[model samples]
Target: MENIRIFVQKHKKVSWLVLIGYLIFCGCFVFPLSNERWSFDFEKAYMIILSYGILATLFTSLLSSNKSIHVYSISLLCTTVGMILRYIIEYGEYSNTINFTQINIIMYLGIIPVFCTLIYWIICKLESITCK
Candidate 1:
């Protein structure tokens, strides 16, 4: 508890970025799953984003290193390995669709990360320039 409070104080900008990013990021998946009764491997996304966001935020904040990388890249290299482990557990929710494996793998492993990392990288760049 004390450590968390201290961490929060030290990484205020990064913390807020993580919370907002997670909400927006997770909301995209959560909204469809809850409202429309449709989702595309929501579990994989939720797991990856949540874990990556938290772990990156904590680790980077601890080191007082790059907030841009922590918040925007959103834990870059941690992604691929985590996706593999998560794929084994939370995959196949969309297995009924055509080319499901190729599509989801491309999505979960390729496009999604690229898109997410790009978004955060841009935001981090802007924040670095504007905020600092």
Candidate 2:
């Protein structure tokens, strides 16, 4: 808890950038999805955005040093929060009731750390290859 607080304090600017970037990225997709004339499939767009976010976070996590796990975690948090906010803004107008079920919330929030772990594995592979 204290560590997380300190980490946020130390990397405020980077964290903010990640949050805003995620929001904008998600918004781009949301706008098209919201259009009734576009014939856009909601599930497809959602999965695309989810994969894109995972890839984006993976790359960002790769850029962090081994000691910077907190940085990676913070970035992941920002990405998840931005995504939720985008969903809220885009869908809130249509639905009077929004039920945030535990499973739905977990699935939404869990993608970050999953990709972060993948990033760590990738980084390890790279380091091993380069060190040889």
Best by lDDT: 2
Q: Give candidate 2 regions above 4 Å deviation.
A: 1-20, 23-64, 87-99
User: After superposing candidate 1, which stretches have Cα over 4 Å from the reference?
Assistant: 1-76, 87-100
Clash count per candidate: 0, 0
Put down candidate 1 lDDT per residue, 31-116, tens digits, no spaces. 22221234558686677666544544444334343444444344333344444444444467552232234554455445444545
lDDT of 2 by residue, 22-104 (tens): 54464333333323333548686666556555544434443444534654565456556665665666575553133244544
User: Which pairs clash inside model 2?
Assistant: none
Worst lDDT run of 10 residues, candidate 2, spans 27-36
In model 2, how large is the Cα lDDT of residue 116?
46
Q: Can you give the TM-score per candidate against the true fold?
A: 0.37, 0.46
